[model samples]
Target: MLLHPPSGTDRVQGLAARLGCTVAEHCEPYGKFKPAVLGSLSGLALTLKEFGGRWDRVERVYVFANWPMLEAALEYCVRNRDEARVSA
Candidate 1:
């Protein structure tokens, strides 16, 4: 999952934890991107690379983020439909 949570709170993280999701923070791969958002296209690519699995084997992705992030996620899903299902 990718999240672009509102600033100055941990509410989203707390909820995700309660929902049994393990949360990890990553630095944005693009210097110009917002530091608080983890759903950028480049960020997504970096994450998948670092995750150390076959990216082509990924089956699902849930993105709770801003418009740009959502668009990028949709594009990724479209390009990898044979391997991934995305909900944003």
Candidate 2:
């Protein structure tokens, strides 16, 4: 699963070109589908932070990871006063 850029912006494609796995689905609402990789959360966060072009245009990241990781990420963001990437 991957985060999409804001509406009207282009959908980020070819991530599989770099990551070696094609996106199984898009528009996967949180809690509805399982994530194939556990590390994608951190990978995406770091990627968006370090490379800020269209990534920064991302408006939300709907988590498909387990509830614990999701809560932890949200808690960390709240504690650090950072914007949450996770969408409801």
Candidate 3:
């Protein structure tokens, strides 16, 4: 998933076409954040490289493998954040 600011549909669609996949925009007034493009890792990488504004517009990009792994990662992130706060 690639999350970017709003109003990048043309760029997103063009990149998605070049990547041989379609894009699902999650812009404001309907969904959270600006937009998020979900597709293959390769396609996402290409889109990020070609049209992702050099990591400017992009707010977050998540790549999950499975439910277990995703859950584990989320747990780890939460624990890490908590530990950091405690240490601070």
State which candidate has the highest TM-score: 3
Q: What is the C-alpha lDDT of each candidate?
A: 0.35, 0.33, 0.40
Error of 1 at 35 (Å): 8.1
Tens-digit per-residue lDDT, 13-40, candidate 1: 4433433342233323353222122222
Indicate the worst ten consecutive residues by lDDT in candidate 1.
31-40
Displacement of the residue 52 alpha carbon in candidate 2, Å: 19
Candidate 1 lDDT (Cα, 0 to 1): 0.35
Alpha carbon lDDT at 47, candidate 3: 32
Compare the candidates by lDDT and give the number of the best one: 3
Q: What are the TM-scores, per candidate, against the unseen true structure?
A: 0.27, 0.27, 0.32
RMSD (CA, angstroms), candidate 2: 13.6
Best-to-worst ranking by TM-score: 3, 2, 1
Name the candidate, 1 or 3, with the larger lDDT value. Answer: 3
Best-first order by lDDT = 3, 1, 2
Q: RMSD per prediction, one decimal?
A: 11.1, 13.6, 14.7
lDDT of 2 by residue, 1-88 (tens): 4433233211122332233222222234343542222223444565333322122123233332333343343334343433333431
Per-residue lDDT over 1-88 for candidate 3, one digit per residue giving the tens place of the 0 to 100 score:
3434345345545544444444443334334443343444442454344433122235333333222332343334345546878999
**CA lDDT, candidate 3, residue 84:** 76
Once fitted onto the true fold, the runs of candidate 1 whose alpha carbons sit more than 4 angstroms away are 1-7, 32-88
lDDT of 3 at 87: 100
